[model samples]
Each structure stands twice: as structure tokens, then as C-alpha cells.
Target chain A: NAGVTQTPKFRILKIGQSMTLQCTQDMNHNYMYWYRQDPGMGLKLIYYSVGAGITDKGEVPNGYNVSRSTTEDFPLRLELAAPSQTSVYFCASSSLAVYFTDTQYFGPGTRLTVL
Target chain B: GESVGLHLPTLSVQEGDNSIINCAYSNSASDYFIWYKQESGKGPQFIIDIRSNMDKRQGQRVTVLLNKTVKHLSLQIAATQPGDSAVYFCAEGPIDHGSSNTGKLIFGQGTTLQVKP
Candidate 1:
């Protein structure tokens, strides 16, 4: 099973341009998350979904939006790309029934550059 | 705001030696801690995790130790190899204050480990 997969492994966008980062998981996880990692730093959550039709903002969700219309797909939208949004974005999924610890599985990652 | 921080930004070790990476968290209420390893151009991968109830957990060639008294967590890699060279991050997750068990994770600044042969 391809635990999780992301589309457009790399992309470059101009300021004000908008695009969506696509993510899908075959594991049928109940939780999905979007995170961005800057150079030499750990990742920070942008948004997350508990299930389809339920989404919540995370630590740094100012410039990003997300939707989980189906259990298999959770896409992140960048409405007005800026230089601050240039970073490696990751998609992860996990099961909530694992009790206190939930091991999140991550996709390869999408590297975005905004100029 | 409460945050997690690493003790070192970079560490270099000779191949076949043991390596230890440390992290200090400000939140004493955090009940779950995790370790992730990321290669040069890849996403972070789960390495190991320990809950507040346990002090130590071992996996393959790695071990995680948690000291609640000082709110410290550490990852130990045994007989480190070239493939073990990567940036390691420690994450803390607190229990959901509400009815649900879902919660967000806070990641610490990564610590890069280099293995020299």
C-alpha cells in the first residue's frame, strides 16, 4: 500500500499566484495533516482534518487552507503565494484508535518556491 | 508559548559508535514524545516514541528515554552507520483537554547528525 502520496513533487509559483498541493493516502486513515518545513528547521503544522468535511487551523495556517472531501484525499490550497510560503510541504496521515500514541505516516513531500 | 528544543544543532560521530541526541521540552503536561528522522531531501520519518507512563522504549538499533522530572527526552542510536546520517527532531503532544483524544504536535529544532567513516 502506498501509505501516502503527494502530487507535483516540485513547483515554482509567482507572488499572488494560487495553487493546491494534492495528497492521498491508501491506508484509509481518519486523520490527515499538512505541514511545512523550512530550511534547517523542523516542520510546523498548517492545517489538519479529523475526517472528511472537518478541518481545523494549526499553528501557521495564515496563508494556507485545506479540505478533506473524501477519506483518501486531503489537499492544501495556497490562495496568494508569497516568498514566506516557499518551503517543503508534507502530507501525513494517522489512525486515531491507537490510543495515546499515534504514529503518523508521511509522504515524500512537495517542494514549493514562491518568487 | 511552550516549546520543545534540542540540546545541539549538529553532532558528528565516528561510524560504528553510539550516538545520543537530547531534547528538552517546556510543557510538563505533554504525555507523548516522538522522534523523527529526515534525510537531505525527504520528509520526516517516525523513528520511535515513548509515552509518559514509560521511561524507556527500544526499537531495533534505537532507544528512547524519557525523564519526566526534568522534562527531558533522548534518542540513542547504537553502532551508527552512514545511513544513519540525518536530521533528528523531537516532538511533544499533550493530551486533548477536551473530550476527544486528538491533539497537535509541537516539533523541536532539528539536530543534524553526521557519521564519519
Candidate 2:
């Protein structure tokens, strides 16, 4: 079973460009999250969805949006991409709330570079 | 503002030796703690976790120790190996069963583990 999968493994975006980073999970987890890992930094939460049709912003969500229409997919949209947005994005899924201290399985991540 | 931080930025150990990584948290109300390991070009993988209710938890060859009184957390690897070389992160969050809670995790700057053969 492919636990968590992310598309567009690598991408380069010009300034002001837009793109969607796709994520999918075969585990059917109710909890999905989008996190960005900057160079030499821990993962920072950008957005999260507890279940289908529900989404919320996390620590750094200024330039990103997320939609969770189905339990298997959660895509992160980058609008007017900037160099600050250039970072590896990782998608994760878990059965229980991370606030409950549940383990999260992560995707292979998408390397994004904005110039 | 909640924050998690590691005591050491890098830890080098000889193969077959034991390794210990230390972390601290600023949130007293944080009830959950977790450790993740990331390789060169991969996502962070769940290594182990602990709750405020427990002092220690073990899995395979790894152990997580939580000290709520001092807001300290540690990850112990029984035997270091080349494959164990990676960046390790400690994350903290509070207990929130509410639907509105987004389950945010405050992560620390990771500690790079370098294992020597």
C-alpha cells in the first residue's frame, strides 16, 4: 500500500507563478497535513484537514490554501510564489489527531524552488 | 508562543555505540511529544512518541523519555549505525480533542546525527 504519495517530485516556479502540490493517501486517514521544511529547519505546518470538507491554517499559511474534498487527497496551492516559498513540501496522514500524539506517516516530499 | 529546541545541533557517535539526543519545550501545557528522523532527501519519519502521562516509552531499539517537570525530552538510540545518520526533530503539542483544534505541532531546530563507522 502506498501510504502517502505526492506528485511533481520537483518543480521550479518563477516569481508570481502559481502551482498546486498534489498529495494522496491510500490509507484513508482522516487527518492530513501540509508542512514545509526550509533549509536546516524543522518542518513547519502550513495547513491541515481533519476530515473531508474541513480545513484550517497552521503556523505559516499566509500564501497557501488547501481544499480537502476527499479523504484521499489534500492539495496545497501556492499563489504568487516567492523565493521565501521555496522549500521542500511534505504531506502527511494519520488516523488520529496529532494533538492526541498519534504517529504521522509522511510522503516522499516535493522539492520546490521559486526564483 | 510554543517552541521546542534541541540542546545540541549535531551529535557524532561511533558505530555500535549508544546515542542520546536532548530537547526542551517551552509549553507547560503541552501534553504530547514526538520525535522524527529525516534523511538527506526524504520526509520526516516518526521514530517514537510520548505523552505527559508517561515518563518513558520504548520501541524496537529506540526510547523516548519525557520529563514534564523540567520540560525536557530525550531520544535514546540503543546502537548507532550508519543508517542512523539523519536529522532528528522534536515536536510538541497540547491535548485538544476539539474539532476546531488544527493539531498544530511546534517543532524545534533538528539535531543532525552523524554516525561514524
Candidate 3:
């Protein structure tokens, strides 16, 4: 089913520069999430969406923003990039029926380096 | 703040041997726990999960054991293969109500498993 897909496999941005990381899922999942993984560390939630037109901030949402205009798309926007934002960004999805404990299918990830 | 931590940063084992990875969580209210395997340059993938109601759950050659008494979580892999070499992370989630009920998970630092043939 191609599970989850993310574009711009790798990107590098200068300070204050902005870019969007695109994510798409064809599993018809009702929930979508964005997470960042630092070197030698686990992932930290950035933002998430319950469904179309519904989005909320996650653990580390200070430098990022997100919007869910459709069920298959959830894009993370960096308004003013900073060095702290340089990390591997991953997009994941899960079904609403089993969102509590279901497996969150992840994309290959978009590695962003902010210099 | 709740956190999940791995006991070891790296584990080396023979290909035919069994491997055990340990994790400790600070939140007693956490009901759901998951184990994820991440290969280099790739995102984390779910290996298995267990709820607070159960102490042990088995899947194929892997098994997850949860101990609420001491707040410990362990993942056991039998007859590990070279393909099993990856970073393993233990995540705690769905801790009670409110913000945690939103289905968020707190991941551990992760343990790198190296299987030697």
C-alpha cells in the first residue's frame, strides 16, 4: 500500500530560511504525526493531526507548524529555521480505531540540516 | 516529566544466541508500551507492544515482558540474525487521561543491537 511516503529525502537550510516537509499516507488513517530524531537519541513529537482540518502541537512544536487540509497530507512548516531544528524528520500514521496501541507506520524520513 | 530509558547503549550477541534488551520507565500510569527497531538511515518500525494488563506477549521469535511492580520492560529476540542488527527503542504511551490520552509516546534513548555471525 506504499504505507507512508515523505518527500525531499534530505535537505539543508540556512539560518532563518524556511521550507516545508511533505508527508502523504494512502492507508486512509485518521491520525498523522510528525517526529524528529536527534543523533543518538529517540524521536520527539513535533505535531499531529486527528483528521482533516484538525491539528495540534506536540512535545516540541516551538519551531514548527503544521496543517491538515486533507486526510492524506500533513505537512510540517518551518517558518524560521534554526540549528536546533536540524534533525531527521519522520512522518507516521495510525488508524483511529486502534490509535491507542496500534503500530504507527513511518516513512523513510526527511533528513534536514539547518546551518 | 515522564521518561523511558534503556539499560544499555549497545548489545553484541552471537547469531544463534538470544538477546535481551531492557528498559525502565518513570511513569507508573503508563498503560501501553512498545518496542521499535530502527535501521540506519531509516525510521523506527514497530516490533511488538504490550499493555499493563499483561505481563508477557509473544510474537514469532520475539517476546515482550512488562513488569509493573518495578516498572521495567524487556524485549527478547530468539536466534538473532544479522538482519536484527539495529537500534532498539522502548516507548511508553497512553498514560492515563488528558494530554496523554491523545496517543502520544515517549521514546527511550535506544539500544543498538549487533548480531555477530
Estimate every model's Cα lDDT from 0 to 1.
0.92, 0.92, 0.92
Candidate scoring better on lDDT of 1 and 2: 1
> What is the RMSD of candidate 1?
1.2
Q: Clashes in each model (backbone N, CA, C under 3 Å)? A: 0, 0, 0
Measured by TM-score, the strongest candidate is 1
TM-score of each: 0.97, 0.96, 0.95
Q: What TM-score does each model's chain B reach against the true chain B? A: 0.96, 0.97, 0.95
Question: Could you tell me the lDDT of residue B69 within candidate 2?
Answer: 85
lDDT of 1 by residue, A1-115 (tens): 9899998899999999999999999998989999999988888999998889999988899988888899999999999999999999999998875345487889999999999
lDDT of 2 by residue, B1-117 (tens): 678999999999999999999999999988889999999988888898898999999998999999888999999999888999999999987778665555667889999999999
lDDT, candidate 1, B7-64, per-residue tens: 9999999999999999999999898999999998888899999989999999999999
lDDT at position A46, candidate 1: 94
**Order of the predicted models by lDDT, top scorer first:** 1, 3, 2
What is the Å distance of residue B25 in model 2 from its true position? 0.4
| Tens-digit lDDT track of model 3 for A1-115 | 8989999999999999999999999999878999999999989999998789989898899989999999999999999999999999999998744435566889999999999
